[model samples]
Target chain A: MRLQDQLLFNLRSLSRQRFRTLMQLIAMAIGVFSVVLLTGLGEGGRQFVMAEFSVLGKDILIILPGRKETSGGMPPLTGGTRDITLQDAQALSRLRNVDGIAPLVVGKAEVNFSGRSKESLIIGANPEFFIMRHLRIQQGQGLLQIEIDQARPVCVIGPELKKELFAAQPALGKWLKMAGSRCRIVGILANSGTGLGFDMNNALIIPVASSMQLFDTQGLFRVMIDVHSLAGMNKLSKEVERVMQERHEGELDVTVITPASLLSAFDDILAVLTVAISAIGGISLFVAGVLIMNMTLISVSQRTAEIGLLKALGASSRQVRILFVSEALILCLAGAVLGILSAEVLLWLARQQFSDLLFIAPWWASALALIVALTCGLVFAWLPARRAANLPPVEALR
Target chain B: MIQVNQVNKTFQLGDQPVHALNNIQLKISPGEYLSIMGPSGSGKSTLLNMLGLLDIPDDGEYWLQGCDGLALDTVPMDEEVRARYRRDHIGFVFQSYHLIPRLTAAENIELPLVLAGIPPDERKERLQPIIQRLGLEQRAGHLPNQLSGGQRQRVAIGRATIMRPKLLLADEPTGNLDSHSGAEVIELLEELNNDGITLIIVTHDMDLGDRAKRKIRMVDGEIVLDKSREQEPS
Candidate 1:
């Protein structure tokens, strides 16, 4: 028979059992939808996190204190003191590979504005902090070098804090009480939103000199260094460790983390999460496959006599096999189309509701969903098709 | 033409062997109308099935048109070849009619031609004359359920002869029909036999057997009597 005729015959036969065909299609669609939506969510979340890190200039590296060993066990914050100083930042800035350095001193404090009090974090850094972290000033001028030199009581407010304190009013140049000390808001940083459950835009930034005075935290520091290129992160990290080890006689207790390293660790965690989520979602596809197989088995039983007649009339085993498999593929393709359309609609609705907090599905995700649907079709239809093909014509007829 | 020599067929059912056909020998020539008559459990149907190539005898040397029937004995024929044989050499009219319910009369008639890889144009070309000859032109688009008993049998005949098979095997082809419809089917088969096609019919009706040129009586898996009318030389 011509290929078209075979396809037409199969299609016509499927149309005869519309309800069963529809059920198979629906099962396939459900399988594709679950897998696609779950994987898309995971992928979108990863992209969102990566975008958040990207906001912190690609060349930047973070250094934090390592957990120290104590008498009984390891303590949360009992590390050998690194005591990173202004001298360390100054020296790092002079390195050929180092573009700039900003020593940060952060602490929690209460801010009062017109009798409205809110607890927020206060960050201490210099003017170069803005460029090193890629922070943009939304409403006012950023902190200047002269302000840091003169120990100016100036600060930059995060977007959320600006909303809480000013509420539609301009926040720049306004005086607010921070930890019982008055500080003028020099700049309102643009909204960077939240990442990893922390609101990046809800913090206050002030000059290191002012923070040191207000918190009585002199000579204590947490430094952030920006390198000229990411290609030198490993070399620069080793060089910084060597320099610090020599300067402090190998006594400095600090941890350095490069964004690439952080990304690799994050990817490993994401890989595990993706696999776990996919496995959970894959169960639904397995169920859908079972449904397909069940439907096909029923179809084979129902068409047993017809199969015998066809075989008697000259239908080969392979043709019968192809017919059933093609039917399954058709059902799967239909389900996949509906699943993808539904997933896109769901993702769109979620994007509308969550805005940028949730990520949108990429094109490759849609393609993967289609591929997954086709695979489900073939895998699910194989056994049933074989069963139909191998059935003895006389026995089937009887 | 067909030939058979000492054919034996047995079936094993749970350690009990039942002989379906035993030491059967028969011959039929082109343009011959023959009938095998017997009661239930006799070997008439088994002989017909073997002749139709739908079954194989456990031991036999059967020949069709000088071809080695035993060569086709063990190996199951592929669909294309079986379809070609069924389309071009054999046509079967079952007791149930066995019309595909979803297909219209014309579509059913076109099936054998379609299976034979005939193009749509040729299918239409071959279908028109047969349908017209069977007086089923008006019922071409009607489904099997829509057609009367006689009309359905006529459509079945059209389907059988669409590919111009050399042999037509009718297994109680009129068992489900009224006497009038049964007579009409017998006439159609006789008319096709007149056109140089070989026809073998199996029936419990002795009157149907008496109408054929040759009659073979089978009992207990063996041929009991074989006779030919004086008008046909055999």
Candidate 2:
């Protein structure tokens, strides 16, 4: 038979059993839908986490005081009682791989500007801290080196803090009181949005010296280091560890986190998550495959006489097999198309609701879905097609 | 031409083996119209099925046009080859008519041609004449359920002979039809036989057997009587 005529005949045969065909298509759609949506969400979550980490300076490294033994466990902050000193920050800055260092003292405090008072995190660091942490100054001037050297009582307010403290009023040059100590706001930082629901722009920045004096946090510090490149991060981390070990005589504790290491660790967690999700979703496809196999087997049994007639009339076993597989493939293709469209709609709705976060369907994802659908079709349709093809015409006809 | 020599066929129904055909021997020439008549389970249908290449005997040899029927081994023929042979060399007229219910008369007639891999143009070319000759030109568009028994039988005949096979096997071709429709189907088969096609019919109707030039009677899987007209047509 002509290829076109064969296809038309197969299609007509499927149409004759519309309800069964529709059920198979629906099963395939559900399979593909689960795969697409779950993978999309996993990918979207990965991108969101990456974006949040990017705001902390891609080349930056964080060093805490202590370490956790197990992988992925949170490391304890070292020197919880004795904080990192500015001298240590300066000493780390002198390292070859280290680009810059910012020693910070963070504490929760209530601040008042004009008539408004709000609780905010206060980070004390020098002017270079802005560049080290990817902070952008929106108004006035940032804390200067001279101000840090002189221990000036000046601070920079994040955009969220500015809105809470000043509302419509000017925030720059305004006086804000923290712990009953008045400090001049030198600049208002641009909004940095939220990272995993924590608003990064709801913090206050001040000179490290002034913070130590105001919060009575002497000799204690949290130091952030910006590295020159990711390639030498491991070696640099070891070098810093050695230096800190030697400098403290093994008594001073430190925890170091480079962006590359953090990313690799995060990727490890994501890999596990992706596998778990895919395995769960894969079960759905497996179930759908079983459904297809069951339906095809039943179709073979029900259409035994028709198959016998076709065989008697000159259809090859190969042709019979192709006809049934073609039916399954058509069903899967239809379901895949519908499933993809539904997934797109679902992702679009998610994007609409969570406008700040990004959810994108990469080209590779679409290609993967297509490949998966075709594979599922073939795998699921094999046994029944074989059974139909191997039937003896004489016996089948009788 | 067909030849049969000591053919035996047995069916294993659970524990006991039932002999459906036993030591059967028969011969038929081209253009011969033969009728096989017997009571139920008399092996008439079994003989017809063996002759149609739909079954193979467990013993003995049968031949069609010098091709061995016993050792006629082609590895049980692939579906394509069997279908091709069925389309190009053998035609079947079943008691039930067995028309594909969903297809129109013309489409059903075109089925064998389709299976034969005939091009649409050639199929149409062959179909138009046969349909016109069968006086089914007007009913070509009607489905089997929409047609009368006679019209449906005509459509079935058109489908059976569309490829112009050499042998025609009819198994109770008129069993489900009225006498008038039955007579019409018999006439159609006779007309095709006149056109030089070998015909083998199985029927319990003695009157149908009498109309054939040769009649073979079977009982209990063995032929009890074989007779042919002494006066051959000139």
Candidate 3:
């Protein structure tokens, strides 16, 4: 028979049983909707984390004071291990492909400026910290390299710290007491938003030499490095490690974290998460497939005489099977369209509520959902379709 | 033309086999009007089914038109080839008027042409004359349930002949109708027969069976009587 006629016949048959058709549509739509929504959420989370990491500079690397374990979590510090010194940072800065380096010494101390005393975070680094962190001096001049090497008491304050200590007044050349030591405010940093889990606007920036004296610490906390290009990061990391190992007396006492490595680790974890959730949603589609089988069996039994009539009218077994299978494909494809539309509507609503979340279901996810739905419908429709096809026309007519 | 030789069909009723057709030998020519009359469970319907290619004989040689080689093997013929033969050469009318309930009378009549893969415009053209000849033009748009028993049977007849098959089989075609509707259906069958289509009817009504040019009586899976009013075959 002409495929158009067969399609029309199957459509009419389904229309006659409106309630059953509607129920099957709902089952399939629910299956497709769950997959779209959950995968959209997973993809959104992955994008959000990747965006945050991208903001930290793709070529930057952080070196911590311990080795990272394969089991993840925080790497334990080796006992009696000496702290990473400023000399180690200087040694790595001289390597090939190394653009710049910033030795970090972070602490919290009381700030007493103009009699407005508040406890704030202290970030201690050299003049190279500005370039490494992409920070611009918003007011006055930055600390000179000569001042950093001489351990002069000159400092740069963040925008928020400036507002708290100076209260809209010009703060350059003002004397500020950091912890127990007094320093001159040489520069004010521009208002950079919160990043890497800290508010850059609420911290104080100073020379490492001055911070070590004020905080009474001789050891550096962390080192940040910038590579000239992505191609040089791996070689530079190894070079840095080698230099650090030599400085630490043949002991590897530092953990090097390149953005590529960190992002890939996160990518692997989230990819698995995406698949796991999609599979969980796919279970519903499987259940919907079972429902299709049961419904098709019922339809076959009910339409026994009709099947006989078609066979008697010269329909072959293969044609009969194609008829039933086409019915399933039509139903599932209709449901897939409805489900995808509804999912798009849901994503729009989600976008309205959470502006930062990209609520898009990737094209492949949608395609996978559609392919899986169609496959499920066809596979599950097989047995009943074969049963209808193989029915003896004479016996069925009787 | 149709031919059957030493045809045998067996059915397993529970564990015991019942022979539905016993070594039956029959030959029918094109345009012949024949009827087989039998009591219940006497193999009348089984013979019709065999002729219609709806069933295969367990041991037989059967052929229709020029397709005799297919009957030589013990195994049944390929279903596709049989289906093609049926589409090209056979038509069937049932007692209960098996019109697809969802389709209108016109669509039901269009079924055979549709199955033969005739395009829509040609199918419409083919159906026009049959609709007028069956006097179903006014009732063409009605669904099966909306039509009376006589009208439904007419629609079934229209559907069966839409493809213009060479042979038409009607099994108890008037069984579900009142006497008046039954007579109309029988007359329709005879009219088609007179127009050069071979007609075969299976019935229990003696009067209906007697009206055919050739009459066959079957009892207990065997033919007891075969009589023809005219000696010459059409």
Candidate 4:
């Protein structure tokens, strides 16, 4: 018989049992839907974090104080560890592939303005800190003093802190008490959204020299460096570590985290998360496969006489098997298509709800869901199809 | 056209072994019209099914020709070979008028040609004359349930002869019909026999059996009597 006729006949037969076919299709669609939606969620999360990393500049590297290496025990009490200092930052800025660098020091201090006092975080940095962090001054001039002796006792107040302290009053050029020292507010920072670790809208920014004097600290907190290119990020990170080891008396204590290393570590973790959820969804496809098997077995038993008639009309066992197998393929394929379309719709809808996070299922997730669904349907339909094909015509007719 | 030597078949019913065919010997020539008449459980239908290739005898040296111009060994033939021959050479009519329920009478009539892999135009062309002869034109689009017993049987006969097979086996062709439709169906079979196709009918009616030029009476899994209108050969 022609392939067209075979398909037509099987379709006619399957349509007779409408309820069973619909139920099986739904089960299959749900299986595929879960895989797509969950993977999309995971993939979306990965993109969101990568975007967050881009806030520090794609080629930027962070230098923290102290070595990250773990040893068997603590060091001797008499020994003192070296801290990353401003002089080291000034030296690293002169190296090759170094575009710019900002030495940072942060501390908690009490701010008393017009008899109302509140504790706030104080960020200590110079002119380059404003450029690298992308912070803008909306009201007055930003930090401009670059030398320790020339740096005056001036501060930039975040917008939220400006509201609480100065509320409907001018904040720029106003004197506020900070950590037992009085400093004049020089700039009102722009209203930017949250950053990596802390909210900048509620903090204060000052010159690194003044913050060092106020906190009485000799060690710098961390240094942020911007490179010229992607390749420069790698070269500068290695060069900075080598430079730091030498400056610290051949002791590699500072840890330099490049964009490549951080992003890749996060990528590995998120990819595993995507696969784990997809497998959980795959269990539903397995259940759908079992439903297919049960329905096919019932169909075979119900159509025994019709199968016998076909056999007597000269259909071979192989043809009969093909008919049943193709029926399963059609069912699964339709459900898979439905699942993919629904997943895309759901992802689109989710993107509308949370524009901050990227919501997109990877290409492989859809392909894997489709291939797995079809395979499940095929395997589940095998035993019943074989049973139908192997049925003896004489007995079946009787 | 066909020869069977000492064919035997047994069915195990519970703990008892029932012999459906006990060392049966039969030979049928081309263009012959024959009938086998017996009570129930006498193996008349079983014999007809064996001739139609629907049942296989346990121990039989059976030879059938006129398909693909090659003689076929019935005993050792596999399912594929048996199916090919069944499609190419044999036409079987059951008492129940086993037309596929979903197919119209026209589809049922052309089913044999479809199985034979004939193109749609050729299948339709070949079926036109048979439908005219069976007088099923008015009922061509009707399903089996919509047609009367006589019309359904005619549609089945049209399907059987659409491939122009040499052998036609009818196991109780008129068993489920009234006398009027039964006679009509028997006359249709006679017309095919007159057209030089070998026709064999298995029935319980003695009058239908008498209409054949050759008559066979089967009892207890064996042929009790065989009679021909004119004495010819063994």
Score each candidate by Cα lDDT. Answer: 0.78, 0.79, 0.86, 0.85
Candidate 4, superposed: residue stretches over 4 Å from native: A66-97, A105-122, A136-139, A148-153, A157-185, A188-203, A209-221, A227-253, B14-16, B39-41, B67-70, B132-135, B145-153, B174-184, B204-213, B229-234
Per residue, candidate 4 scores C-alpha lDDT tens digits across A1-398 of 88777777667666767888898889889989988888898899888877776667677788998777778778646655687877898899899887778889899999999898778889988878888879888899888756733447888889999999988998888999987787889898899756666578988988887888888887889888878778767778889999999998898888999767878898888788888888888887788788888888888888888777778878788877887889998999988889989999999999999989899999998999999989988888878888888887887777
For candidate 2, report its TM-score.
Answer: 0.91
Better model by lDDT, 2 or 3? 3
Candidate 1, residues A188-212: lDDT per residue as tens digits? 8887775434465888888887777
Among all windows of 10 consecutive residues in model 3 chain A, the one with the lowest summed lDDT is A72-81
Candidate 2, residue A261: CA error in Å?
Answer: 1.1
Native A-B contact fraction in model 1: 0.39
Find the candidate with the highest TM-score and give its number: 2
CA error at residue A141 for candidate 4, angstroms: 3.9
**What DockQ number belongs to candidate 4?**
0.52
Whole-model alpha-carbon lDDT for candidate 1:
0.78
lDDT of 2 by residue, A109-146 (tens): 99986667999988778877888766788898888886
lDDT of candidate 1 over B36-79, digit per residue (tens): 99988797888887787666677877667622333332224454
Of models 2 and 3, which has the larger TM-score? 2
lDDT of 2: 0.79
Q: Give a tens-digit lDDT track for model 4, residues B180-221.
A: 999999999999999999999999888999999999888879
Arrange candidates by DockQ, highest first: which order?
A: 3, 2, 4, 1
In terms of lDDT, the poorest run of 10 residues in model 4 chain A is A144-153
